[model samples]
Target: MTDWAHHRFTANDLLLDRQLVDSRGMMAGRIDDLELSDPEPDPAGGGSAARAPVLTALLCGPIAYGPRLGGRLGTWWAATGRRLRGDGDGYPCRIPLSLVARVDRMQVRLTSPRELLPSYRLRAWVADKVIAPLPGSGR
Candidate 1:
């Protein structure tokens, strides 16, 4: 694996709210939150571990975005997403860090296709149940 520790970009400046594009150049979603792994203890006898807390996944969806917004409305928005999901777990969609191909000033590009992402569940649901049923939606 390439050593991401050597990379100099700040996560907050480069990743937060950046658009995520799949390998097919399809828009998946904006990065709403980053999931970092806890530092693991080193087995080589030093007090410090070889790996520190590292970015593990990208979280996308209202559940992730709402906490960042931090207000009553944000809470409501997140709750609505949870209700729609009906999973009782309320966790936001997580895209593994391994799928990230590159990060630029405007967006983060993925190594996977957009259709494989869990983040598109709501959009797909709406399209199938609502948009597809419209009179002129080309059904």
Candidate 2:
């Protein structure tokens, strides 16, 4: 179990697309992007040197995923997400970095259960707008 807070890591090398597992070991989702704290003066007291942004959260789902695709398809997908969200921001579900307990070759483990994560909002929306409208689905 790597202590992510103290370790130096490249987000793209270790995090993107990694499987996410909740405390109970249930599959939560894949990491689509990472959120970093705005750069700040180094806590180590380096006079004017700015510290690299620290990882703050994990972003998941289609809205975050689109940027990683990078090109015409990515642009179209992200725009579609913003249109669907209708809120302009279109930020995907964000799981705080504090919840992350471990990271390995293929997975990023969370200390809390998936129920505590906001990743389900998209699923709920789809159920309401798409699934519930199906002929056999009982609303």
Model number with the top TM-score? 1
TM-score of 2: 0.70
Our model 1 lands, by Cα RMSD against the true structure, at 4.2
Which regions of candidate 1 fall more than 4 Å away from where they truly are? Answer: 1-6, 39-51, 135-139
Residue 91 accuracy (lDDT) in model 2: 80
| lDDT of candidate 1 over 82-135, digit per residue (tens) | 887788878888998888888777778898898888888898888899999999
What are the clash counts of all predictions, listed in order? 0, 0
Best by lDDT: 1
lDDT of 2: 0.80
TM-score of each: 0.82, 0.70
For residue 43, give model 1's deviation from the true position in Å. Answer: 14
Candidate 2: tens digits of C-alpha lDDT, residues 15-114: 9888999999989889998887745755885645345666788999778988889998998887887677766777877898888998877689999988
